[model samples]
Structure formats: C-alpha cells, structure tokens
Target chain A: MKTQNIPKATIKRLAVYIQVLTGLKRDGVEVISSEKLARACSVNPSQIRKDLAYFGEFGVRGVGYYVHELISSIKQSLGVDRVWGCALVGVGNLGRALLRHKEFALRGFSIRAAFDCDPYKIGEVVSGLEVVCTRQFKARVEELGLEIGIITTPPERAQRAANYLVDGGIKGIVNFAQARIDVPKNVPVEYVDFTHHFYSVAFNISSME
Target chain B: MKTQNIPKATIKRLAVYIQVLTGLKRDGVEVISSEKLARACSVNPSQIRKDLAYFGEFGVRGVGYYVHELISSIKQSLGVDRVWGCALVGVGNLGRALLRHKEFALRGFSIRAAFDCDPYKIGEVVSGLEVVCTRQFKARVEELGLEIGIITTPPERAQRAANYLVDGGIKGIVNFAQARIDVPKNVPVEYVDFTHHFYSVAFNISSME
Candidate 1:
C-alpha cells in the first residue's frame, strides 16, 4: 500500500478501527458493514470507507468486510503484526502501571526492560523484570534490541531520559511526563500526558453544560 | 461564544495549545506568532488560526497574539478557566500517578476525592483525600459536587463504576480502563487508552523508516 502524507487523525482512527475490529473478532463476529463499524467507532460510515480507501480497498460489494481479514490488513498497515520490544524508563507509578497492563502484550508490544534513576528502585524486580539504572539505558536498549522507549520519569528528568533513549537508538518514545521533551526528527514522541487527558475530558464535560 | 458543533479534535488541540502556552508563560514569554505556536504545537499555522477563528479572533495583525490573553481565551473556550471538581475511581498505579501529577492542579482540574474496591486501600488517605469504596461512589460524588468522574478501574468494573457515576449526576466520565463502557447520552466519555497511544507512536515510528 502506498502510504504518503496520511493525516494523523486518519492514522488515529485506523488504530481505533483495529481496536473495534479486534473486539468484534473476539465476540465471534464474522463480517461487518461500514455502518456497523462506524457505529462502533463513533465515526461516519462514509468516513470509515474513505479511511480504508487510503490503504487500498479491502471491502467487497454488498457483503461488507470480513472481520479477521480486515483486522489482519489493518495490523499489517499499522506495522504492528510483529511484536515490538520496548524499554520503560522510570519504574514509577505510571511506568509500573504500563508494565503491568496486559493490552500491550495483546497488541504485539512488549516491555523488554525497565530503567530508573532512583537507587531504591534500581535492582528491584517489577513484572518479572529487574529495574536497571538509567545510566545503563543507552547500552541496555542496544543490548535488548528495544525499538520503542517509554518515559515515565519525573518532569525534571524527562528530557534527559529522552536524550538517553535517543542515544540508545530508539525508533520512538511514548512520554508520559507532562513536560514536552525534544527528540530528533526521525524519532517520533507521543505524549501520554494524564493532565492533558483530564483537560480534554473536562472541556468535553463542560461543553455538555 | 457559539459553541455549537466544535469537533472533539478542535477541543483537544485547544487543550494542547493551553499546555504549550502555559509552558511559554512560565518561561516569561509575552507574545507569539501563530507560526511559532503551530511549531510548538506540532500543528500547521493555518490550522492553529482556523481553530482560534472558530472561537472568534484572539490574534492581532502583525503583532500576532498576546501570550497571556490567548491562554485566557483558550481556557475560557475550553471551560477550564474555572476550577473543576473531579472524582477519581480506582487508586491503582495509573490513578496514583495522576493524583500525584502537579499539572492537573495547575490546569484547575482538582481530584476532590478517590475510590477503590480493595478493602486495604479503601480507607487509606492519598494526596490528602481518603479513598472511599466504590459502593459509596454515587453518594460521595453527590456530596463532593464532582462535575466529572474519572474511571481507572479494571475492565470488568468500569461499566459498573460508570453507572454509579452517571446515577450520581456526573457531567462526564474520563475512562482509562481498556474496556469501553457505555454511558448516558447527555454524559460524554473520553477514553484514555494507553494501547492506542502506543499504536499511534508505533505507526509514526514505522513511517519514519
């Protein structure tokens, strides 16, 4: 599939569609119409069709889309069909939560290792993996073949941790810190800021009033 | 302001712009151009202007925007200028991290209370607030006058927690559970799914390759 300049929103919706389809597949559902998919995703049916058209057509006339087939195609398009090894920096509460989250494993993403600067946390085993010192981040990332790095360090140390991850040759960083950290152009960073999430929801709630 | 049909994406961006501006404000920056704001936000200048235009003009020609003024306008538009009381259910690792996050307090969203099903954790005081049982969710939400309910419970309990919150008259729900919970029509739910964030970053990282 020719992927060029796909809108970020579309990419996000694609991920959402994959999630919805995965749920449907688990429910023993076979085929689903764009209308059904749209309802599940809270998107318009035409929009769903339009999004799919970008990656090439997978839908047949009248019969809608085969659930498992569509999911497989999306997984391939998303480059998540293969398992990705990721390293977690900062074994704090947020990092601990993420490491314990089972959805990552289900979606082919695994936390191969965790790192922290705290001496108390260092050498402690969490989720069956020992929390290594952040000083060893670059070398450890390389040694573990980690592609993505998750930053859950405190705000003051976030940028430094990001720098370490970049130096470690990480392809991406999922930063949970509220502070924005600069990274190289080639390395994308996704901010999973809980504060921003709270604001988004609060604003949405306020608008309802 | 005629806040009729503003897209969720627009509202989310507004929240992000608030974050960027807040950072700039702390740095003692007084004024900024849309181009600069867009660069800081990782969005196009035209898109930033378009978003602001939806809520009426905030930028002056040639001089661009007054940093403080723009933040005020965005906050007002987002209905976050005033403090919002939110009830948090499930004081797990992720929830604990959120309660400890200083950004939320800075943004005027305060966690007025917390809840959990665990007997050991139920009566424990965290961040100056005692954790109540989920059984007390509805009554406590009412007593606290919480405008929003945040669900960080496990998948199985999410829907039930949502039910109590809704019954207690929460204007919205910010759910972090991996499971999708159904809510009332008037009450909107914002999902804070970490898996989706990971996939978004993964797709972007894949595109860089």
Candidate 2:
C-alpha cells in the first residue's frame, strides 16, 4: 500500500476498529460491513469506509472486511507485533495503576522500569514493576532499548520528565501530565489529559442537568 | 431555533469547537470563517457548517460566525456555564492527582468528597477536599445534592461504588474503573478506562511507526 498521511483522527479510529474486530473475532464473528462497524464505533458509515480505504483495498467489493485478517494487518501496520519496551516515569497513583494493567503486556509493551524521584517509593515494586531511581532512567533505558514512556509526574515537573525521556532516546510519549511537554521534532507526543476529558464529561452532565 | 436531534458526532465536535474557539478568542481573533474554524479543528469546512447550522444560524451569508457569540452559543450548548458538584469515589493515587487539578475548577466542577474504605485516609483532606468514608457517600451526596460522580475505584469494587453513587441520586457517572458497571436504564454511565484509551493510543502509535 502506498504511504498516505492519514489524519490523526483516522489513525485513532483505526485503533478503535482494530479493537472492535478483535472483539468480533473473540465472539466467533467473521465478516463485518462498514454499516455494522460504524454503528459499533458510534461513527458514520461513510467515515468507516473512508478511513479503511486510506490503508488500501482491505475490504472486498461486496462481502465486507475479514476480521482476523484485518487485525493482523492493523497489528503489523501499527508495529505492535514487536516487543516495545517502555519506561513509566513517576510511579505515582496513576502510574502505579497503569503498571498493574494487562493492556500494555498484550500489546508487546510493558513498563519494565518505573522511575521516580520520590525516595520513599524508590526500590519498591509497583505492580511487579520496579520503581527505579529517576537518575538511572538514561542508563536503564539504553540497556533495554525502551521506545516509549508515560509521564504522570506533577505538571510542574512534566516537561523536565519529558526532556529526560527524550534524551533517553524514547520517541513516543503518553503524557497524563497537565502541562504540555516540549518534545523534539521527531518524537510523537500523545497527551492523555484526564482533566480535559473529565472537563467535557462534567460539562456535559451539568449542561444536561 | 427548532430542537433538532443533532448527531452524537456533531455533539462531540461541539466540544472541540469550544476548545478551538477558546484558543481563537484568547488570540483576540474577532471573526472566523467556517474554513478557518475547520482548519483549527482539523475538520473539513462543510462539516463545520453543517455542525454549526444544527444549533441555529450563527454564520451570516458573508460575515462568517461572530467569534465571541459563537463561543457563547457553544458554551451554552455544551452546558458549561453551570457548576456541577461531583463526588469522587476512591481517593487512590489517580484520584488524588485529579483532585489537585485546576482545569476542573475552571470548568466549574469541584470534587466535593473523596470516598475510600481505607481508614488511614479517612478525614484526610486531599488537595483540601475532604476524604470521606465510603459509608458516608449516600448521606453526604444527599446533603450536598450531588448529581454527578467519578468512580476511580479498582475493578473489584467498581460496581459497589457505582451502585452507591447511583442510589444516592447521581444521574451521571464518569467511571474510570476497568469493570463495566451494570446500571439501570435511566442512569447514564461513561467509562474512561485508561486501559481502553491506552490500547488505542499504543495501537495507533505502533500502526504509524
């Protein structure tokens, strides 16, 4: 398939589609039309086709897309098939919570080392992941060839943490920190600010009420 | 204006519009055309017009949308003008981190109570918000007239926490717990499971890498 600059929205939807397909495969379903996929994703049918079309002719003319085949394609396409080591900085409450999660394990990425400056939490294990000293982030990351990191540090310290991760040679970052981090041009940053999402949620409820 | 059943996709974009408008307003932009708004939002011009037209005619045939007025209308449509007193269940690390955030304050929702069964944390003021006993949820909620809640409890206790919140008169809930809570048809529940969003994020990163 020819390379296309797929919109970030489209890429995000691709992940959602992969998830739905994975679910369908688990449920013993095989083929799925754009209409069914759109409904399940709470998106328009035209959107599903447009998004899937970006990757090439994954869908047949009449019979719809194959579930298991698409999952493999998406997994390979997303580069998730290879083990991507990650470091979780700031083993705070949210960081600790994420360390316990199985999603990272399934996707071939795990927080093998969680770094923190908090002396009290250092050397302790959070969800079986070691809480390493932040000072060792560069050396440990180099040793493991870690590719991604998560920043859950305080907003004031988030940028410093990001710089630390970037210097450690990580390319992708998922920042839960409020203050946006400055990553070099090559790094792809995804800000998962719960406050932003929560604002909309609270705003919606209040508006409805 | 007629009360039209705007698509959920359109409703979702309204939130994005508010964000874009807020940014534009901060920059002292006096007026913005649909194309420009779409550019800021990364959506197409036609989609912007269709979305804006749903609420009523905000754009003149030639003058485009009045930046401040459009923002005002969007804010009202998003129900952000009013304050919503929301309780937070489970004052774990993630929950505590959320309590200190100022974004929610600007959005007009305050975490009135943080509930946990841990006796060690009871009576401790987290970010100045009282950490209350789980046993006191219903009474405190009734007294406070809380209508919305955030369930940050672990997966095991998620349902019980959800039930307690709902029974106490919460009409809406933002569940961060991994478990899908069973709710009566009347109650509205939105899950913001980090695992789910993380899966999408990492999956997308892998796809494009």
Candidate 3:
C-alpha cells in the first residue's frame, strides 16, 4: 500500500477507529454507517469518510460498512494485523506499568523483553518478563527480533536508550520521557508526553473562564 | 487578554515553546530568534510566529524574543504560571507511575490525592500520598480544590470515576483509560491514549517501507 503523505493526525485517528471497530465487532455488530461510527469514535461523519477514503472505498451504498472487513482493512493498513515483538527500556514505575498493561498484547504488540540499568530492577521479573541488564540490550533485541522499542526512562537516560534501540536495529520508538531525544532520520519515534496533555487541559479550562 | 477561538493545536505548541524557552533561560541564554526557537522545538518559524500572534505581538522586530519575557508571556497565556491541583483516580501500576512522575509538579500540575477501589491499595502510600477509597474521591476533590482529574483506572471503572470527578466539580480531565466517558459540555476532557502513539509509530514505520 502506498501509505506515504497521510497526515499524522489521520494516522492517529485510524488507531482510534480500530479500537472502536474492534468493540463493535465484539458486540456482534455486522454493519455500521459512517455517522454511527463517527459517533462511536467521537469524530465527525465527514472525517470518517475522508480518513477511510485515503485507503479505498469500503462502504457500500446502502449497507454502510461491513464491521469485520473494515477492521481487517484498517489493521492491515496500520501493519498491526500480525504480532510485532517489542523491547522496553527502563523498568521504572512507568515501564513496569506498561509491561503490565494488557491492551498491548491484545493489539498485537508484545513486549518480549525489558532492560534497565538499575541494579535493583535488573534481574527482576515483571509481567512475566525478566528484566535484563542494559548491557545485554542489543544482543537481546537481535535475539528476540524486536520491531519496536519503548522508552520510559527518566529524561536524562532517554537519549542513551534511543541509541541502544537504534544500535539493536529497532526502527520504531514510543517515548514517554518528557525530554526529547534525537534519533536518526529513518527511525520513527512517537512521544507520549502527559505534561503536554496536562498543559492543554489547563489552557482549555483557563480559556473557558 | 482575549484568548477566544485560538486553535487547541496552537495552545499545545505554545506549551512546547514554553518548555523550550524555559530550558534556554536555564542555560543563561538572554534572547532567542524565532529561527533558533523553531529549530529547538522542531517547528517552523512561521508557525511559531503565527501561534504567538494569536495571543499578541511579543517578538521585537530585530532582537527576536527575550527568553525570560517570552516565558512569562506564554505562561500567562497558557495559565500554567499557577499551580493546578489534580486528583488521580486509580492506584494501579499506571497510576503509581504517574504519581511518581515529578514532571507534573515541575510543570505546575500537582497530583494531590490518589484514589482506588482496590482494598490492597487503599490507605497505602504511593508517592507520598495515601491511596484513598473511591468513595472519598468526590469529597477529596472538593476539599483539595482540584481543578483537574486524571483517570488511570480500568475501562469498566472509567466512567464512574468521571462521574465522581464531575460531581466533585472538576472542569478538566486527562483520561489515560482506553474507555470513553461522556462529560458535560462545559467540562473539557483530554485523552492520552498510548495506543494511538503506538499505532502512529507503526504507521510511520510502515509508510517508510
């Protein structure tokens, strides 16, 4: 699929759509209209059609969309139809939380291994995965064929974790650190900063006043 | 200052610029040009100017923006100059991680109280705050004067927590749960779904292929 040039915001909504559709499918919903799906996803109906049109036509004239087929198509477009092994760096509180988060496995991204520099955390078993020393990170990533890396390290250590992920051949990263880490051009890094979320809410509430 | 109708995206980037400017100020830098700030923030200079223009003209013609002055101006516009007390519902691993995260306090959002339904977690201190029973949630929010609520609870319990927050008079929410909760029109909710971040990286990597 020629997936280039799709807006990052649209890519984000695709994930939300996947979640909404998964829920609909589980409820035995066989078909749904764009308007209904938009309501489910908290987006507008026009946006639902526009985002999906970037791929191809899946909606029937009268029947709306087949819930099963749309889920399959969105998953395929997202490259998450198959399982992707992931390596997590930093077994700190946040890392441990993500390790225990059940949704990742349900969505086909598995945290196959975890690494940390802290001696207290090293060799600890969290969420059934033994915490490995950071020195073994590259070798372990190669062994496990980790396609993506997740960094939950403190700000100071985030850059080093990214370096290890890159050296280990992991191409994608989900960084939760507040500090921005520089990565090579080809490596895709997604930041999940809650501080930004906090500030956004604060700004919004202040604006309404 | 008339702050109506400013795009939420611009408010978000202003927060980013505030962080960048704060860092520059700490480094003893006196003044910064939009070009330098743009490079630091990974945003275009034109966009930075446009975002600031929504607030007011802060940048001088030739000297660019004074780091200290711009930080104060942006903080005033975003309302992060004042601390926002926050109540966190759920003391699970994710909730514990957030309670331990120091960046919230550093950025003017304080997680004052934690709540959960788990008997094991209730009354236990995590990150210096004792986990209160969920029944105490609304009362604590009233006592603490919490303006924001952070929901890290499971999907099933998310809406109930939102109900508690709303009843307690929380006007803003930063929900980390996978579930969607309906709030009143006046209460603005911000969702921080890491799955969206995960899929964004996956899609970006897939597009590169």
On DockQ, the leading prediction is 3
Model 2, residue B199: displacement in angstroms? 6.7
Give the per-residue lDDT of model 1 (tens digit) for A171-198: 9989887677888888988887566566
**Model 3 scores what on Cα lDDT?**
0.87
* Candidate order by decreasing DockQ: 3, 1, 2
Every model's TM-score on chain B: 0.95, 0.89, 0.96
TM-score of chain B of 3: 0.96
Q: RMSD per prediction, one decimal? A: 2.4, 6.3, 1.7
lDDT of 2 by residue, B1-209 (tens): 22334565676677667666766777799898888888777679999888877667787767788889998886665565567788999987667766766666665677778899889989898888778888788898767868778898866798899888878878788887655577775566766644434544455455455
| DockQ metric for all predictions | 0.56, 0.20, 0.72
Question: Could you tell me the TM-score of candidate 3?
Answer: 0.95
Q: Which ten residues in a row have the lowest lDDT in candidate 2 chain A?
A: A193-202
Clashing pairs in 3: none
Question: What's the TM-score of chain A alone for every prediction?
Answer: 0.95, 0.91, 0.96
Better of 2 and 3 by lDDT: 3
Candidate 2 residue pairs that clash: A77-B207, A78-B206, A78-B207
Q: Which stretches of candidate 1 lie over 4 Å from their true place?
A: A59-63, B60-64
Q: Write the per-residue lDDT of candidate 1 for residues B2-112, one digit (tens) a residue.
A: 265788778777877887888898899999988998988889999999999888978988988999999988878777788988999888877887777677778898889
Q: Model 2 misses residue B109 by how many Å?
A: 3.1
Per-residue lDDT for A1-209 in model 3, tens only? 64678887898798888888887887899999988999989999999999999888889987799999999898887777788889999998899999999999999899999999999998899999999988788888667879899998987799999998888888899998766778998999887777778878888898898
Kindly report the docking quality category of candidate 3.
Answer: medium
